[model samples]
Target: MTGATYDALVIGSGPNGLVAANLLADAGWSVLVLEAQPDAGGAVRSSHELADGFVHDTFSAFYPFARASPVMLGLDLERHGLTWSHPPAVQGHPFPDGSWALLHRDRGITADLAERAHPGDGEAWLRLCADWDAIGPALIDALLTPFPPVRGGLGVLTRLRHVGGVDFVRTLLSPALTMLDGRLGGEALRTLVAGNAGHADIPLDAAGSGMLGLLLTMMGQTVGFPAPQGGAGELSTAMVRRLESLGGEVRCDAEVVAVETHRGRATGVRLRSGERYAARRAVVADVGVEALYRHLLDPSDVPARVVRGLDRFEMDPATVKVDWALDGPIPWASAPEHAPGTLHLAASRAEMAGATAQVASGYVPAHPFMLAGQMTTADPTRSPAGTEAVWAYTHVPQQTRGDAAASGPGGTGGTVGGDWGPDDRERFADRMQARFEELAPGFGSLVRARRVLGPRELEQRNANLVGGAVGAGTSQLHQMLLFRPVPGQWGRAETGVAGLYLGSAAAHPGGGVHGAPGSNAARAALAHARVSALTALPRSVGRSVRGTLGRGTAGGGAS
Candidate 1:
């Protein structure tokens, strides 16, 4: 009820938070975003920490999910200073046998490459691409839409009716490892398929996970792996700028410690600084599910069922990312195309599986699958000319069992401890670097400077990446789609509390900078606001009528 009041108070000025704020403000509502970090964008930030003039994307780099995202593309980010850089080839997976599987942006060229590898593999690629065309649009719609996905789901069903219902459902939920195993003859092609899906914490054999890679790969094929011209942070800058232009304000370093509520509804928020802001319409939380329910709100206000479900809400695999200000482009045995686009260092399907299994067992994998990006190749502005700013990240154990067997490959037979200290960081980072060295000799010498961030460091940078689980939470079978974040609040942004919404990666459509969680949260808040108004209309009218009648009765008595 003061100057500080806003129509909506969004906690955490991440991409999702800004999306909600921008949408709310664009709809003629006052919105304010509170960020814990000094800057916005959450995980999608870039910095020159590696070395001066060498801009390294601190967290996420590739934008397959973001680029093809309906929410992102529809937002007109280009007009807000977000420029995309695409490499000649979208992605390449090279093997030790002087061969690689290159996914070209051009379908014909990709098909030709596939045909050269295996007889019918080329046709399989075409058929897969065609299958994508059939349901891809509908699938994207279904993914971005709020849960239940009536229209988008039905659209996909209609498109795939000829594919047969049983097989259709099977394909939708099939594991990527299973889908591409025998169909794509060569290990190179198979690795490409499964490796793409492995981008998430979900294992290769996990059902409902095969769809992840298929979706990303198809999206990459259509639109190359585009990143911001300057760095990943530029995308965030554009979104924040767009939000500000819409009259919404983002306050960085505003740590939201609690969600102030009255009568079972979110009333406002209290920052750690002890500052408070009233929410006239809603309080949308772009924080994690655990953080929102366990810490942000009072225990009594949170639903008991939600608290219990939070316990079961599996955290995704932990990631260890290393960025280096390299002297020059990576010298790969496979030559130029090896380091182009977003590259996966894992060689075979078996290799990917073993690494994921190690992660599953809470063991630091000796041979972890790594995803490295050649920033200079995509956008030269990321570093000085002739030099490459490269980054590689791989999943590690969230907690070690303290068993000696958990030590990374070829190690003594015991746990090295779970904490990510300087030793742990350097040791694992060396293993990852050595992996690159195997694929591209002399990879270690190219580094002029490097920054290594394990789970703890990543969590310290962004709390939303709890335990360094980057995909927000596990992309597991029981946690996908409607079951994501939580079972009840799937597909929508509103949380258990009325007038409160979860807008972070922990919400429906889970993880990635695609903006589905934020957009959907905004839409949900708007929908709830409309419903509240409609429901209160008759009550408000009745109250007015009674007041008038009471006044009339009082006047008559006076007379």
Candidate 2:
């Protein structure tokens, strides 16, 4: 290996990759990052091409987890030119009738709004809020840390022990409908709460769906949905700046082709263009698990059990995103009190559940739940004066089996294409626009320009986002914890192969812009490098083991 090569090579320039590079560089290791795209920030980026002076988030818009992440906080992103802005109200759900339920940052105000909608809902909101407030931090800790959550798991257990884990788990077991029914009375209020819970691919009736509502609500109250100051890309820009400041280098347009190994140990990587970069310390992959195991490493290099575990990989629902340059603020029947936060366009809990169920069953919902955001409302720089940059996204079944005709003219039903071709993109966008028109009349007229990206487009842009599954993988219970990626692979970011580590959303503490996986991987690489210095002693011990337990067992155990 050449000494000119870096000590650490991060194979993706996503948030996780940047974080890992920063950590390694900060620890005095020469780090390099290779990005397949022309720029950094895999999914966290913004562009003004949708309309002049109108900046729109290319992908993820809201940053609930980003604000609360300890890793993000520790970086003091604000100092790195990151600023957060929130709307007056966190979110709102508008109904056909002249009624709207809003989520205010203030619990009291939100409770009062719930009360106005339904008498006892105020108390229920307060109780749920309080319960979440107690466990929210612990949950974040458990999530942001590596899996097994040994420390975080212990903390959660300690907190829930007195309350009883069974009871706590049971409390979160009820479907969103059941929970909302027990808590709120009005249809609008129920829709407001349950719609937020349906952000993931999980059906509202799914076992762990309730936690989505609780966690998102608590996070919204705590940090509000915020966007970067200049644009979504600014967040990524800040990360890149920090990594560079720490002596890290990022090479864009460099796609990793394979993980090079020597003597059953990962040694470096080969780029698609045939360029090779050796890792003196570690090779951190910020790509999807499927890409990592199936494409990058040789099958013989990966354990057979790990390969079988890939079958259990459950992806979140596919998403259809629409970005529009609005002539003005959305024309709601009853003007919402706050600058538009996230708008939920559903009326009842059952309606929202049915919509989610429809999507889960490979059918487009007649009344799809839409999450609309006015980006410029939160950050004025997003659009020209008197105009708003808005976006809406909804999840659909991954591989819906049907024809476009079956779904009618403007439906999503078709042989699930690998890429959301231009035709399907336009159709999905039109369907969403029609939905908005029904919920808020004349909404279509306000659009100055429109752009759409379906699951396939999203995946093409960012290989890390396989199948356009944004939440990395399914955030459900079975795929979470020790079972994340695979069991017995917790704590250490490295796989069984030396010098190779999983540092993407596919790893534990999955998804969001948290950067925990990258940080964790960097720490593991540093430890491994330190341990390498004492290899002489280990070699002597290895000789004794070989003499005692025959050559087969001795070299086999080491391997």
Clashes of each: 9, 0
Score each candidate by Cα lDDT.
0.81, 0.77
Best prediction by TM-score: 1
**Alpha-carbon runs more than 4 Å astray in model 2:** 1-3, 161-166, 186-190, 403-419, 487-492, 534-559
Candidate 2 weakest lDDT stretch, 10 residues: 550-559
Pick by lDDT: which candidate is best?
1
TM-score (all chains, Cα) for each model: 0.93, 0.90
lDDT of 1 by residue, 504-552 (tens): 9998888877888888788878767755555576887857755655532
How good is model 2 by TM-score? 0.90
